[model samples]
Target: MGRMMLKNWLALLTAVFIGLSLAVISIVPPSPQGLDTPDDQFSSARAMVDVRMIAAAPHPTGSEENAKVRTYLAGQLTALGMDVDISASTLPEKALARLNRWSGQSKTEQPIYNVIGVLPGADRTKPALLLMAHHDTVWASPGSADDTVGIASILEIVRAVNETGQPARDLIVLFTDGEEVGLSGARHFFSENPLRNKVGAVINFEARGGGGTANLFQTSEGNGDAARLFARAVRQPSGNSAATYIYRILPNDTDLTPALKGDYAAYNIANIGKAEYYHSPKIDADALSESTVQHMGSQGLDLTRALLSADGFPRKKPDATFFDLFGLWTVIYAPVWGWAFLGVTLLCYILPLRRDMLRKDTLVGAVKMVGFMVIGGVVLFGLNALSGGGSGADYYDRLAAIPRLEAVAGLTIFAVFFGTFGRSQLSENGVLGATLPLFILAVAGQSIAPTATYFISLTVLLCAIATFIRRSKQTETYGQWISAAVAAILIGYMVSFGHLLMLGVGPDLPSVAILPAALAVLAILPLWRGLPKRVVTVASIASLGLAIAIALWIRLDPIASTVPLY
Candidate 1:
């Protein structure tokens, strides 16, 4: 009984460690400790001054509120010792047509204003780094997170840069209008304006929601040199090449679209948390996350400084393989190096089999584990369809249902894990077997999409090494503790990766999260001597019941006050 109790205690401790790991990775670093030295760097508090005024109302393009925003921006830029230029242009016919389609309006003409400010550098002829954000909000939403954060971040970046003295190259700030309408202001500026010729590179700030990790999502093709600069400059980066690849295929578009068409190096960054508040009427200045604001401003300032000081823009080279390590730092390299990681993990898994002497247990265990992955994935896909994620479900409504959807996903994934693995005890050989499916998947990913798969591949490699260590050690306690620590790190990274994935694609495809969650749980299987089937059953039932309760509550609870008024 005492031994059983000790095992239970260890299990509890392990659970706590995993929780702490997740929390640490998910937190947006708080706004820099104290602003006593505000003059030395970009300050979130100073930036909020602009966010408050700009996000005061729903300032849709061509509205009187938007006009007021334009006036305020011009004055602020002028105060920063910039030569401010405001140009108004009629929205293109295609953009006006889209506006009419989305709003059912019959307006024949729409006007958008573009704001430009220039900070002279020591050298006048050097290609300038263009900083961009759109000032207009959606029709009925304050849009504090949508583009206001971007605009405010740029304003603060400019203020902080001035305090550092002149840059080596010119810094041009572009606050675009009519972004929510259809990137009309950006299209006009990049297509018609003469300033486009002065730009060597571009840094565009944007937001999809009110809070969460600010990610450097998109970069121009041939981002090797550019990504290297970013990795060295940004102190805390929450980005990965996988996301960049995925974003290329997604239908989402931003003001960066028009700019990407030009011969310039471009980077697009955005925060996507508390996504239910996106374009919602409840998005006032107070709703904006101060941590998110700080994250965006700090990363932008760092990258801007780096670009301004460089001899010239990064020369175009092949895309680099990059991802952050536990949100602490970035790891970047050539895609070819992924094979080295894959080869090592393959050897790790293969080497263990020699000791077991081609036993039937290894093969059967591997096949069973593969079955588990397939069954779990299919079940999740089906449940997602039933949980307000069907083909005809309203997109915006699904956005509002995200919290409940997450609960459903959590419960369903746990239930699948219990149902599949509850009855069996995974021996040392069985742990090796479980990694086989992941290894196969990794090879495919490495061959087809190296960047997207490295997170999984590298994670599997670490876990496999932990497994090898567990197998070689005669003492069970040493194996448990050591393997547990490695598992914690692997799980921690996955939790953060999964959160970012959900934020990026949850409304449309939440089931995909099951892959990482299941793999991470399996990575720690060596510690589960035998989680009692009864315990697993009870936990699964309880989680499902709670998930059902949340789903019903979602049906009954009042629509979020933030939901768009329209």
Candidate 2:
């Protein structure tokens, strides 16, 4: 018995290590490159980038704050003494008429404008490589991030070329309006575009939710002809972040999308239906990729994709979020998921579900161990929360505030035991045995100091383990499974909402697995306990089939994923 206890304890240790390991990996901020610092290391490229920043200052067209951005772009273009053409191409008639037809509604949408500056080439009729940026933003807060930066970038590049008094393929810098409002500016521009035939290529810049996690992945479809040229010419060693770099091609949504065409259908198409979007990392993690589109479209270009992102994951630091987990935020759902996992093991003991090597009594003890483990965690959490000058935020926030995943690892340990404890049946001894492992996971994440959400989840899962240990049979009834099912549905239904709420898997995979399994278990319980075997079995199977079929449909058949920008 002592040896068996030791083995389970070891397994618990393994799980804690795995969970905390990932947590640590996430908080690892990469070493900042001494790239182009103004003091001494500033390279010519750095100088160019900095100068560009000053020239493009604030061209946001969405709100009053961003209005300054637009004024700045105009001012910069005027200062350069170039032939500037401000094309009111965004809110043109035909596009709005079509938008009204598509959204199944209509209103006098804003007139989209494009600030077009043409610098004629030597033998000028060749389509020029136009530079583009949307003069708009996500919120009324400030367009400084999403596009003020992009607009400013265009101004610097265009102005620099103008200063040389030599045009590179007839530079046409278009500071587009209504880019947020459904590529109205772009769609309007293309409606009768000479630039389409003449423009050889384009360089479009985009700002995410934040500033400066510098990266530039190719966002165009034309292989990489001009893109490689720019990258090679603009070559400077990229910034390094110590953690995972989530640099996959985001399907069209950012301001760059309008320009890219498939990406803006504007930016993409303007670059002749194929172009690249210069991007940064900050926006991807928390906010504003879609806000730019949604905010614009809501004024009624009917922005959808950029209004709402594709993966719907918690991205750029959004304006506000509902991922508010009060007390049991962190650990609450982990167990909800963990219970499914725990049930798999416990089936060996109760359902005679599967043949496994782990002893039945040990499994039962593990399920029952939540109480002892959580009690220990409560004390630890209280002390740590107290000791750390705990903010009015979750563990993830505090951890992130402190900025290290390892700092919050201890809390994660607490949640991990919540998992093992959920699997084991309640027993006084079992609770005692589970305490140490739970403490370990919590301690690990706590050590890393995760983001507010991460730590909160960690804490909730820890408490859940404790609750399980104390309750002994939380899942003993059909009502419990029904409750679990409801929770799963709500959480799963909102996966696309992302950080707007804390329920991620609550909306996707867990709900997929849980909703049906929960319903089936609830429906079949009466039969398994003594109802007519045939009647119960048939009803259970039908219910399972229906539930799963619905889940499959939701997963497979996407309703409004690809929205038409035109």
Candidate 3:
């Protein structure tokens, strides 16, 4: 009984640690106290002033509100002790026709303005660091989160940088218009403007929702040098190569598109949560998450400061494999090194089995684990379809349903575990069997997409080591401690990974989170032996029932005014 009690306590302790990790990393930095009483510093409080003014009304391209925003932005830049230039162009005739047909308006032309401000460095010879943000909102939406936060962040970043000292190179701020209709403003600036030649690096801030962690999601091709700079410069960095690879395949568009075409290093960062408020009529000053604003500003300020002070911008190099360690520090290596990790995991699994002589029960357990994952994936796909997923569903509506969708997915996985593993006892050999499929999947992932598979391969390697230790004589206590530690790390990493996966592809591919979730659950299987069957069954049913009710609520909820009219 004492041994069983100790096992249960370990389970609880692991869960608490996982929760603590999530809570610490996911929080947006608090608004600085000096914001309102600004004294030559960049503060979200002061930035909020601009966000309020820009997002006070809908300011789509060609609208009077957009013109007002342009004039206001020009005035603000002028007050910042810089010469602000406004480049205005008419929308191409063909694009105007398309917009007319889409909006059912007979408008034949639309005007766009690109605002550029130059704060010359003490030395004028080096290439400039460019800061980019759009200034227009989607039609009928306040758009405080989408680009207003970005615009406000740039203004604040400049304010803070100026207060520190004159930069080593020219600091250019490009606030482009017509971003809502398309990337017209950014395209015009990067393609036609002479200032494009002066730029060596670019940092673009963006948003997809009203709140969530701000992810550094994209970097220039061959970003090894640039990523290293970022990892060293930014505190509490949140990024991974898997996100970069996925973004390459996604059809998403941002102002960074035209910049990427140029010979300049670049970064794209955005927050994606409370997504129902993205581009919605309800996106106002109060609707915006101040913490989200602070988060963006904090990251932008740090990177900008580092770049401005660097001896020279990072030159192009081979891309690096990088991931954050519990949001504390970034670990980077050459992509080719992923093979070493995969080899270690393979050896750990196979050598242990060889020593134990490959029992048949172990093989059976491996098969069952794979079967469990397959069934879980199928259940998630079906539930997602029922929860207004699939191609026919409105993109924004599906985004709004993410919270519910996450719950549904979680409950389904829990239920599957209860019905399958809760009733059965897995001998030591059976436990070894479960690792086989995970090991195979990790190997495949490492070979095909090393960056994406690190979470899988690394966790398996840790668990395999613990398993090996457990098989030793008179070292069972040591093994349990190591296992608990492994579980804690895996669980923490997976929590952040799951949230990011949902944010990046939640509307269409939430089921992908199951891969990490399953691995995390299996990692703690030893402690779970003490978990009661009745407890698992009841919790499973309750969670599933709640998930279904939430799904129904999502379906029944009317289209919020926050969603786009089109």
Q: Pick the candidate with the highest lDDT.
A: 1
Best-to-worst lDDT order: 1, 3, 2
Model 2: residues >4 Å from true position, as ranges? 1-72, 89-109, 162-165, 222-227, 237-251, 258-566
lDDT digits (tens) for residues 1-566 of candidate 1? 57854774586378548845664765555454235546758788888888899999888887889899999999999999998999889988887876676567889998789999999999989999999999988778988888999999999899889888989989999999889878999999999999999999999999987888788999998889999999999887878899988998888899999998988889999988888888888888898898888889888998999999999898788888998776678999998888998888877667656656457766766876776667656655665665656677656666777766777767776776676666666766777677777878888999998877887788678877777666574654465666777667767777777777777777677768877876677666766655677898897778767766666665566656667766
What lDDT tens digits, residue by residue, belong to model 2 across residues 1-566?
46644544444344334433432322221232233323222122322343344323322233343455455556667776657766654355664565456445574764455777776666565445566667654322233444554554444344434444464346567777766556666665655566655654455555433322223333344222322222223222111110001122224454444344532212221110000111221222122232222111111111111111112211222111112121011111221333343333233223322233244553454333443334433433433343342444232222222211112222332232333332323332332233224334444433342212232223224333433433345544433333233233223322212211111111211212222222212211111112244554555445434433433333243322111122
Candidate 1 regions exceeding 4 Å error are: 1-12, 15-19, 32-37, 98-105, 355-357, 473-477, 555-559
Residue runs of model 3 more than 4 Å from their true location after superposition: 8-13, 16-24, 27-42, 98-104, 350-357, 530-534
> Using Cα atoms with residue i matched to residue i, what is each candidate's TM-score against the true structure?
0.94, 0.38, 0.94
User: Global lDDT of each model?
Assistant: 0.80, 0.35, 0.79
Comparing 1 and 2 on lDDT, the stronger one:
1
lDDT tens digits by residue: candidate 3, 288-372? 8887787788778888988888998888898777887766678888777877877777676666555664778788778768867
